[model samples]
Target: MTVLALGLNHGSAPLDLRGRFAVPLDALGERVQGLRQHLARAQPEVAILSTCNRTEVYVGLPALGASACPRHAMELAEPAIEWLAAQGGTAPAELRHHSYLRAGADAARHAFRVAAGLDSMVLGEPQILGQMKAAVREADSAGALGTTLHQMFQRSFAVAKEVRSRTEIGSHAVSLAAAAVRLAQQLFDDLPRRRVLFVGAGDMIDLVATHFAAQKPLQMTVANRSTERGRLLAERLGAAQLPLAELGQVLGQFDIVISCTASSLPLIGLGAVERALKARKRHPMLMLDLAVPRDIEPEVARLPDVYLYTVDDLAQQVQANGERRQAAVAHAEAIVSAGVKSFSQWLDQRASVPLILALQRQTETWRQAELAKARRALARGRDVDAVMDTLATALTRKLMHGALSELHGSAGEAHQQWADSLQRLFLRDTA
Candidate 1:
């Protein structure tokens, strides 16, 4: 078994398809537990990183024997893929079509890149690191984190920090929140004159609302399922707050609406928008739905007076500005490459632990036997020098017994192989 990363991102899967697999952040722990039970035989260490842009499952399976090295990675990852598909209630084949799998060193490289935001929709966007940290916390809380995955993420965070500090990758980073504001600007010339309503007090809404606030919109209000949560964000932005129930009643009051919630269902329906549009006397409204499993219905985009943009639509706008940061991409990739190499070396060392332990145990047993014999000889009135010399001779013989036996038994190519191995193991120069 090996480390494997299996999932589909915005680039690999469409928005609608991605939403089907987008596990809510609050429910991540539960989903992880379910997957753990499903793969109990493998006893895999699992972490699910689910965000607006991607849903990835990282698993560190129990170590395999040298003979099992020939087994394919997908054979080990199939259980995870099936469990994930079952969670989404999606067809396994459909998930497989859009998903990509990374194994061993490749999985480590992918994790590092993802944490560094090199794999995000918006190049060098910093939010992914925080999202990754949140995923780690959730997985750890669910009792799914183990040595392999814990080390991988801790190293990933370090790499991300190095990439951000050592390079200017984030210098021109255009985040989805910033992209939403840019798209809204395109539809509405006077952002300062438009009243904005943010339908959610979650992280994404907080981000997008902050971007809109920078423009000093005419008025801003946060409408959330919980008035208390909405009020907190509203106070930060110096805006008003309203419970989510009043959204339809006051929806028309705001000219620009942004919604991102973990509702698992559309918060803004066609009828709600149609009613709001009619109340505005057909005045156009700019609505940005940054939520996966969408906060705004797809059908709402049909209304002539409303412009609806989802996360995918915003990603296109974000990508157009990605070329400006191209110069820094190479610098970030170099850091990630070094990180992957280091992690691979660490993994190799961990694999050698069993052999190392066995060798140490065997040598200790031989030493104990030689020491006992020397003590017995001394008790029998043997000369101290003779006993010491005899102990040294016996220990040397015992230490070289296996190598000598192998050399004596082998012939031709096999003899040469054993000879070379012994020379490297025992005859190598050490100062």
Candidate 2:
């Protein structure tokens, strides 16, 4: 089956479109199962990798001839788009402009680069690799991963590691949390006086909390679904913990709310933010939603006192660090290219497995027939040693027969090329 990848990401789509395409982490397994069932009717294998930065579908299908694989993929995408739109309160048409579709080697390379964080808003950020790995693991557990998709993801991870180790792609990296801190600095002159409420105990939340804590916010609290994980992170930062249940009532207590959670639905909607704003007497509140499916509702952005930012909005704020990482880009790109070539070669070789098996079967059949004839000769009271020698000679001659016939039949350039190749493959020379 040929491998193909399709999807949209931060670079190809705006926040609205990305929000429309985001898949909830909780529903990912069911989504993958649905995709598998849908694609299995025609396409044999499929895997999905969805993150805050991108939503990609990788499929393994029969040869492109008269196949509806692309159409099937679009059909599969429709439900995902509809689901995302319902979550974001947007229409599919409105989100289409922001979507991108990639196929073949380009798709493979894109996956690798994404895992390496080259395509991230904050270039060379490391979180995306882990996120992608988690997605792959989920897909595998859901039985969405087949040979082609499995190989692609495995090689993509390898490429990411190679790029990270061989180049400075991840060196001097500015994470999304760090970028959020920079943005908050632009809004507030002094973070020390500001109350920061982190709504989630995930890694992103932890990292952002650490950055905000370094600034020594006047007060900090971690509100999470599980108070235990929240308290763990809160204690590390000398912050307090609150149940997510208290978020609506206590939202007004913080000047900043940075949330990153695996919640499938929005935790902070427009009404909650509006109430919080009113409670705060219209004080400006900086809100960052780093979750893929989104922790904050898009409508919350319309609130006068709520300055909301999604993952895409932060991309513009992350500078390329162009000159400092220019040398690293070439080195990283070379590593990715080599990785892609090697992966492609392996994929091509994999496609020839059936033919290789057929050839092996054919050779074994001939060997077995010759062995039977040798056994009969020995049974007829012929010398055992002679029978063994005859069997060995017959196998060798049978193995070379096709090559000798081809060499004799070949003409001109073909004959010379075959002779040269044969010499290189088998000949030994003495001084």
Question: Model 2 residue 315 lDDT?
Answer: 67
Give the best candidate by TM-score.
Answer: 1
**Model 2, residue pairs in steric clash:** none
Output the TM-score of candidate 2: 0.81
Runs in model 2 lying further than 4 Å from the true structure: 41-45, 61-104, 146-148, 299-305, 320-324, 377-431
Least accurate 10 contiguous residues by lDDT in model 2: 63-72
**What lDDT tens digits, residue by residue, belong to model 1 across residues 1-431?**
35889999999998888888898888989988988889899888999999999999999886642122425777888888888888778989999999998888889899999999999888888999999999999999999999889988999999999999988877778888888888888888899999999999999999998999999999999999878898999999999988888888999999999988888888889999999999999999999888888889999999988988888888888777644476688899999999988887777778788899999999999899899999999999999999999999988898889889999999999999998999898889851
Provide TM-scores for the models.
Answer: 0.94, 0.81
Local distance difference test scores for all models: 0.88, 0.78
What are the root-mean-square deviations of the candidates from the true structure over C-alphas?
2.2, 4.7
Which stretches of model 1 miss by more than 4 angstroms?
A: 64-70, 322-324, 408-417
Q: Measured by C-alpha RMSD in angstroms, how accurate is candidate 2?
A: 4.7
